[model samples]
Target: MLNKVFHLTENHTTVKTECIAGVTTFMTMAYILAVNPNILSAAGMDPTAVLLATCLASFLGTMCMGMMANLPFALSAGMGLNAFFAYTVVGNMGYPWQVALLAVLVEGVIFLVLSLTNVREALFNVIPISLKQAVSVGIGVYIAFIGLQNAGVVVNNDSTLVSLVSFTDHFRTSGICALLAIIGIFLTAVLYLKHVKGSILIGILGTWILGILCQLTGLYQVDAEAGYNSLIPTFAMTDFSKLGETFGQCFRVDFDGISIVNFIVVIFSFLFVDIFDTLGTLVGVCTKADMLDKDGKFAKIKPALLADSIATSAGAILGTSTTTTFVESSAGVAVGGRTGLTAVVTAVLFLVSMLFAPIFIAIPSFATAPALVIVGFLMFTTITEIKFSEKDYVKAIPAYLCILAMPLFYSISEGISIGVISYTLLHLICGRGKEVKPLMYILTVLFILKYIFL
Candidate 1:
């Protein structure tokens, strides 16, 4: 039955290999179970509720990917999109969390429509290879920057904009996040370099144990008042009362003046990022699994993308951010995952996470920071495939801008917008206007109008 369903024998894989790959994939991306709730908590939502929502969405989305698309990809609340929902939409823009969720729902519905049509599939031709590679690199840099900030290796400076930690004062402090981060990075890197499977998971566990030992030995003191403490794992912090309040919040979008504009921009940003992110993950992971056809196209990509879109919408309704295909799925492919059974096993693990919310939430920022950094390194590997050696600086310049602008602007949409617009203008200037697609022209105009009017 398993072979009939997942074609395990035909794909040169076994049930044991698929199961191991699924567990490995879950271990690599399980940090999201902790990170998403922590980030979304800033939006005034309950952390425990976000935890439940994250796991639930991941389980459902990944199950769909397995049953419908028969792909070995896991879906979860995306990191950058969650940060945008919290810091930009709810924090800076002053929109209610409910309305922000509404924007995610709208974006997901639009994505679903596009996926159902042939329009989304045709995007492979519309977007240039250089820009696709650039987008992946941009996301890599962005995730790494986020990891550094989360680990306290990077901090904000009023004058310099950003600065590294000063070990003089930092070492004097009992709770030294920088030290733990360095240790985590070193450990994870060493393990990965040695070809150890589940290196990220092992690193997180090792760091957590080290933190607890430091606390117990009085090397790292807990300052409860300052909210600084040792990384002790426990099941005492989960709170589910607010879960009821956030349910069905997607129906609460405001139709007022500023809100209307905010709604449009937020949805557009989520939709744009999710589309490219899923496309990149599908292409990269499937290529590694040898699931791509002779044309370099992913098999059953439409259903996979649709599953992602539906997961995003489901996540919004369940009180979280955008749920999309995780780049970390490549971790499973690396471990010989080549069938939907891998995803099925992963979905079951996610479902089990719902009962262990406090254990998941007990993971500290310093422990998981290394995983993000390492994953960023994996994604940035695509930079080698980009064509940048030619004298046609037009193509290379836009690609470089896309890579740099993301972390600089702290927004994925801005980087993509600038890259696409620059690609259009440079091509037109170089008498290569015919290469630009009608949809690209439309997107260029939409981005321009968004900048000027909203």
Candidate 2:
């Protein structure tokens, strides 16, 4: 049975090979299960509960990917969506945590409905290839921004028009560490391109060891108690009252001074980011896996989207913010994960890690910083696939803007919004408006109006 299941010979795949692939995929993506909860917990949610929800959702989503999509890709709460949840919804919009969860739930329900009705496929078909490229590049920039911020390379500047590098003494340690990690990523890429096995793991491990040495030499101090471990397995009881409060927050139906217009803006913002983020991830990863059928549709995308939406809804109920498919699955796909078995393996690892949350918590962000940067570069490679010779700046401009603006704007949604709006206007100006689809035109106009008027 083991031999049959793991066979990888010319005639048959070996169980050992499958297990190796599964484990490799899981390790590559293990950071998501931990990082999502870490970010959400900062917004005053119970950390342990968020961790549980993250694990459960990831496992369930990945399982669905395996069972339904039958692809080797794994899924989890995404990086950009979580930032939108924490910064835009909760912080900028001034919505309470529970209400934000409710908004996520609503978005999930909408996503589920769209996926089930097969509207998702139609939506995928209309998204210009250039727009898709922009989305991927936008996400790469967003991820790089996250890495930079986490590494303390960029900080708020009170004196300048825009934020400047953090030259303060406190950030020096983190800054140096981040530079080293970036170097490690480049070296790893060179090695991997040279056909080195496990280059990512090697690069990450080397950087981590360097960080540890820095700590030992007193160049940097290690925070032994940085992450929340008590929040795992059974850390905090679910606050039922917070649920009602959160739901109210979601719709901005509060007695507080927050206005209805502001509430609508926040809700729509959540809906927009979550929808596009999932769409972009699905298209990018599926394209990489060659999963698109002759019709240019994901063969089993409905189920995968349904799983992603369901995970978001469940995550909100479990007391976290928005949940969506993670791009870390790209690493898994890049390494030759070709079945849902990879996701199942990733899920199992999350479950096991629950018992040792403290250990996971101990892994400094610097340790994972290299992986994020490297993955960003890996995804950015898709830019080469775009046809630059095309005369229509409508396509070229948006694609180029997406790659450049995401890292610069420090937001994936913002970059995409710019790209979409630019794409539409360019098409209209060039008198090539007929080439643009109606739904896409509407989405573009809506996004523009939302950003400008709202």
Best by lDDT: 1
lDDT of 1: 0.79
Candidate 2 lDDT: 0.65
Q: Highest TM-score: give the candidate number.
A: 1
TM-score of each: 0.84, 0.81
State the TM-score for model 2. Answer: 0.81
- lDDT per residue for candidate 1 within 1-454, as digits (tens), equals 9999999998898998788778867866777887788799999998878888888899999999999988889999997899989999999988889888988999999999999996677764466767777777777777677777877788789999998887566452423766887788899889989988667667767877777777777766676565464467566644556677677977866656455665787788788788866775665455445575555555488889889999999999999999999877766766678889989999999988787766655566676677667767776787786777767578889988988888898766677778889999998999998988788888788778868865
lDDT of each: 0.79, 0.65
Compose the digit string of candidate 2's lDDT tens values, residues 235-292. Answer: 3333334333233243443536656676666666677777776777777666655666
Q: In candidate 1, residue 452 scores what lDDT?
A: 87
